[model samples]
Target: MASRCIVLLVAVLLSSLLVVSSSASSSPCTFPAIFNFGDSNSDTGGMAAAFATVSEPNGETFFGEPAGRYCDGRLVIDFIAQTVGLPFLSAYLDSVGTNFSHGANFATAGSTIRRQNTTFFQTGYSPFSLDAQSWQFAQFKSRSQLAYKKGVSYKDQLPPEEYFSQALYTFDIGQNDLTSGYVSNMTTEEVKQTIPDILNKFTDVIKSVYGLGGRYFWIHNTGPFGCLPYVLDRYPLRAPEVDSVGCGAPFNEVAQLFNAELNETVAQLREAFPRAVFTYVDVYTVKYSLISHAEKNGKTHQC
Candidate 1:
């Protein structure tokens, strides 16, 4: 009789827990759109479009054709959408393929969180730069308007809110700001002074995306510069460290400071925008792991 009572009690507790879990699973931020804003790492095509260069050799391995992305193909933003049952984001230049009813990508090849990167990347524009992906995002609304006028709407039937809810906004920039601008030229002390300013600007960008009805937001820290080809070429002496997965102290030190500031900034943003769902993907960690495990994946370290 005592055993029966215990089993009955356990069953009741399980039932109660199920109710709680179900209620918590329903988040208001579960929307339908996904906006991606970042550099080559997350850019699906912003760079390719700007450079007028389609898929590169490395990119051909994954995405096939040239979708303007910088990776082997598909990036974090692509998987994020797929995780939520959304289709791959359409490229900014892909007029016929774009489906803004959900979300769009605004990541250029050399984009950064700072205006300096914005003004420095594009050879023709120099200041016209690859980092102005966010500016392209501003054009989405107008582009949508014209899409309808041109009779090329992807989802003319759905309500805006329903469409927006399905969206996810992401910003994966700053790599160039750190990698291109400061990493090569400036000393540690000079870079330290600018870290706070960099963090603050990134925080503001996250909030801006949220204000645009972007409930789902993600911020990327930075990709490893030590692993890039340029770094390998510049510091051949550090090849030993690279092979050991022990990054050169100087480059790694800069990365650490940047990541620390990034973490603190992310924490502050979370508190400021309690209603917004913010996630930070640690690209540094990913890069490090990929470097350490390159051989396991049957690949050799390039940079």
Candidate 2:
């Protein structure tokens, strides 16, 4: 199930890049770099740096050692970097051997789109929420500018305009937000009401990136949370509440509702930034389809 989801996301991102490259007559490194923001789904090594629990089997399938990725192998973002002729992105939180040349991963596990004053599920405040990530990005931009002004070469320093203006900004978030709400016992309608605030923070991130000269944006909406192994095991539904595919219908509906609003938000962003390109990938549909035909996709696990 994990492999299926990761592969689908990689395919969608690569396909989108291909289409853009073809139309613009650009190569794999069409953009100067890629700046990614998200949670565990796209985190490369943030969790490992911040926590000691991530080790061993977490990255053994591919790296043969712990590399901080939640999965046993490379993430979709790693594949996207490979497809674009760039090296794997180094997590910003990683202090050693950190390379910010091709861009950096600002995603952290358990990150939320909003900062919380109260604890959720015994989890304290996240230091790398969407807001905090944006601030880190802004700091990166500042340092890059300062480095450029000090006569540093491109290889040794990050060029502000070349890296920021031409970079592909990608986001894959909001799953944790919904998860927190559900676990906190919020009703479906209450969770739905939180969508606007979540999206507003997303919008702020986009606008902040735009101000930093970002013009290409790839936004991924939340996937089928109801079908995840964790959710399936924790919240078993009655017969009527389960879908034909054995997923919890109510939970899936909440995800769909969030995706719907996210799509609309992307459309509005395109209008607001006429010169920028915004692509909203329908991740939920792609993931759900793979789950529906698990045998055909070589997925044996129910999740």
Candidate 3:
């Protein structure tokens, strides 16, 4: 399974650069650190630190203990870190025994691109939206620099000043933004209407990071949430609304639409910031293909 994951990730990692460069290069480049922003798909436990720790079964399968991630083992972000020769990112919200020298994760379990009006307690939507995570990154950069300058002792745990500009900034959010709209009893059209504002806010946050010296960006488009039982149960579909593999068609349509808009947004971002390197990963294509293939059998898969 680990090997399979590595192959998949490496494929995506290589594919990500295809847009920026004419061809993918085999040569290696090292990033001193990684700054991640996303939801559960890449969260290293911001939600647990802010609210409650995820217990047992969450990490027992592969990690041998609760490692603060939402999954049984490491997340996609973890694999990316290992692939890049960096340590796993500590959750920015997790203060206990965390090391920021390598990088920090600002992703929460229920995070969205746009802030939801309802509380997490009410709808399980995170208050730490994409905009909020960007703010946290800004604060962390300034504060960690100050801490690093204090002494050599503090330098071991904090990142250096130069690492800020050289580090890879990764994003794996927007899935929850679409799901949040659905969970709020929104119609499909209503959810589609929110994409423009959401992408605009996403662009704004990217600009914020760019202003702070972040130059390299790796962004993952939202996955296929329509195949999940959680979404299927809530949004009871009509007979015609079910796809060939029995996934919610309307929900998947909305997700695809979101990915398309996000792609355009990335194009615009590249134009706006000519100096920055942007890698827009097509996670939706990979995830949807996997889920559809799995559903052809009697099984279901979740990202």
Count of backbone collisions in candidate 2: 0
Question: Tens digits of per-residue lDDT for model 1 on 1-303?
Answer: 000001112223323432343355566334466777766656566556655675355356555656665554456566556655577776665555555666776666665566663333332221322335555665565566556566764646222544544465666666566655443467656766677877777766666555655665666666566555555555554445554675555566677788878878888877988876566656676566666676664543121
Number of the top lDDT candidate:
3
Candidate 3 or 1, higher TM-score: 3
Backbone clash pairs for candidate 2 read none
Measured with C-alpha atoms, the lDDT of residue 12 in candidate 2 is: 51
CA lDDT, every model vs. true structure:
0.56, 0.77, 0.80
Output the lDDT of residue 230, model 2: 74
- lDDT, residue 294, model 1: 60
Better of 1 and 2 by lDDT: 2
Candidate 1's error at 78, in angstroms?
Answer: 2.1
TM-score of each: 0.75, 0.90, 0.90
Native-referenced Cα lDDT, model 3:
0.80
Q: lDDT per residue, candidate 2, 1-303, as tens digits?
A: 121244644465555654664476445446668899988878888767876547667767778887878777777788777777778888888888887878989988778887755542366334578988988988988887787787666536353557788888889888878867876788778888899999999899899989888888888888888887777786777899888998888888999999999999999999999999887877788778878887777733221
